[model samples]
Target: MLTLTENASTIVKTLAAQAPGSDDTGLRISSTNEEHTAFSVGVADAPEPMDLVVESEGARVFLEPGAAVALDDKVLDATLDDRGSVSFAIGLAE
Candidate 1:
């Protein structure tokens, strides 16, 4: 299963909380291509029926099948730039 770093967990929680509807809203990741080398991220009110739900440290991430497989042994991390922009990255889990 994919894991979230502390930075990623905090950032995801903040961003997801901004959505107006469900408290279960979370960050969603999906593969951009068949190779699963690229991913797109967004806030979703709920996971798709087939999505894999990953929760850590109060944060939740929904992953499509390809993305879930691709990221299975990875870690999600984030950083907030000086201008308030957030960037997300993936790394191998040790």
Candidate 2:
């Protein structure tokens, strides 16, 4: 299963809370194209029928089947850059 670092969880929770219909919104991850060579992440109202739900620190993330498989045993991390912009990094679990 995919796991979120503390910072990642906090960021996700904050984003979700600010979204409209926050109660039903979660972070959704999926392929950017049919080839699955890239990915896209955004807030969604709900999970798809076969999506995998991963929760941590009050945040929820819905991963498409293929994304879930690709992220298995991976860790989701967040970092702030010099410009104060936040970004995410995905890596194998230690």
Local accuracy of candidate 1 as per-residue lDDT tens digits, 5-83: 9999999999998888698899999999999999999999999999999999999999999999999999999999999
**Relative to the true structure, how large is the alpha-carbon lDDT of every model?**
0.97, 0.87
Q: Candidate 2 at residue 81, lDDT?
A: 75
Worst 10 residues of 2 by lDDT: 31-40
Please estimate how well model 1 matches the true structure, expressed as its whole-model Cα lDDT.
0.97
What's model 2's TM-score? Answer: 0.87
- Prediction-by-prediction clash tally: 0, 0
- Total clashes in model 1, counting residue pairs 3 or more apart in sequence or in different chains: 0
